[model samples]
Target chain A: MEQILRYRVQNDFSALSRFLEELRGLPGYARLNERQAYRLGLVLEEMISNIIKYGYDDSKVHEIEVVIRWGDMKITVELSDDGHPFDPMRHHCPGSNSAEPLEQRPIGGLGIHLARQMSEEMTYRRENGRNILQIQIGGGVAGD
Target chain B: MEIGFEMKDKMTIVHLQGRLDAETSPAAESQLLPRLSASGGNWLVDLKDLEFISSAGLRVFLMLAKRARECGTKLTLCSLRPGVRNVFEISGFCTIFAIEDSPAGI
Candidate 1:
């Protein structure tokens, strides 16, 4: 069986926290093991935080739509925002070269990088002035 | 999130409890950054009770690590849960910060 959940989240930290708590309360969430739940939360937090921080240029409030499709072995999240046309897949991840000294490493893209690493698959697209990102988690294979 | 401090030897053990995500990261940064100084000795962040961490939380750790380096001090993390450890490793933070299984020795 599959379950679908949808939420309209405000572009703010408080809303994000509330949404995350609600997500944890879902019946499907109970099926996820500790590691899977943690990865899901991390991916959601990283992606939504980026949208709240950089997806907008104006100070106006916006609503981000999130859809979660919870399956028996996998969970998929679809996030749509009307803020900007940014693609997370193409975002440059700095500070990844471990060979570089710590002091010289820049800390700009670690968030997106972490999100990408935790999720099984991530795809981004722009449609009708909205940036839509879909991320899949579970299936037992994540950044081992 | 709640942060408590304990002094062991010359090291400062920071106990972090609760979730450290975007909602709490700003406060965590403000509260933790001012405590680091050149004269201060090493720091070991204890995340045993920390239920969750996101990129925002990671950013604060990165900043703290950078500041600790600038102040000529060492920063280590210990007692990371499996979930938390995965985040650190995936972000390559494991290479930057010294990690321990427990807070046994500084």
Candidate 2:
């Protein structure tokens, strides 16, 4: 058996913690402690913020959808937004990772990079003109 | 997130408690920057009570730090929880900003 929790909220950042906090009461959540919860929260927040700030730049109406399902060994999270389409997985940092001057190096692209560092697997797709992001959390993965 | 500010001697410390995720980031940016700008002293961010912070929160900090540098003031971060510290370290912000493990040493 699996558990799923779904939520929809405005395209804002203040509602993110409250949205993610509702998942703490699930059965499998007992296996994932506060540190794991914090990682999930961080990644989800980064994705949501990017969607609202850059995807929906015109401040139009939009909805954010989050779904989490847990099994015996893995936790799956799906975050979808009905705003403009943004595939953060495709973004690449423009710097050479050199010790060059700060002004000459690029400043952006840290969000997706951090997500890649935290999650076991991350996937992005655009279906029906909506940005959909999927991430999986496994029990075997060590905490960063 | 609830934000409280305190001024001690020549430095202003901003205590950020709770989650500094995407939604609460803008409110923090709007509230914290103006105060930091108006004050004539350096800023030390106390994140001891902060349970979580995302890249959006990091973005706000970077922007505020950049603004502070441009205005000839210093911005420092102290007392980061383990979760928040990992985000900061993973994002390479520890190199970009001044960070300390404890407020007592700063």
Per residue, candidate 2 scores C-alpha lDDT tens digits across A18-129 of 6656655555666666666666666676677677677776666778888877665566889898777777767774432434344554555566777767787889899998
Each candidate's fnat: 0.71, 0.48
Recovered native contacts, candidate 2: 0.48
Q: B1-106, model 2: which lDDT tens digit per residue?
A: 9998898999989899987766677888899878877988998989999987776677678777777887788888999888888888777677777898887867
- In model 1, the runs with Cα more than 4 Å from the true position are A139-144
lDDT digits (tens) for residues B6-58 of candidate 1: 88888888999989888898999998998976338989999999989887788
Task: Give candidate 2's whole-model lDDT.
Answer: 0.74
Worst 10 contiguous positions by lDDT, candidate 2 chain A: A93-102
CAPRI accuracy category, model 1? medium
lDDT of model 2 at residue A86? 71
lDDT of 1 by residue, A58-97 (tens): 9888999999887767889999999889998888778665
DockQ of 2: 0.38
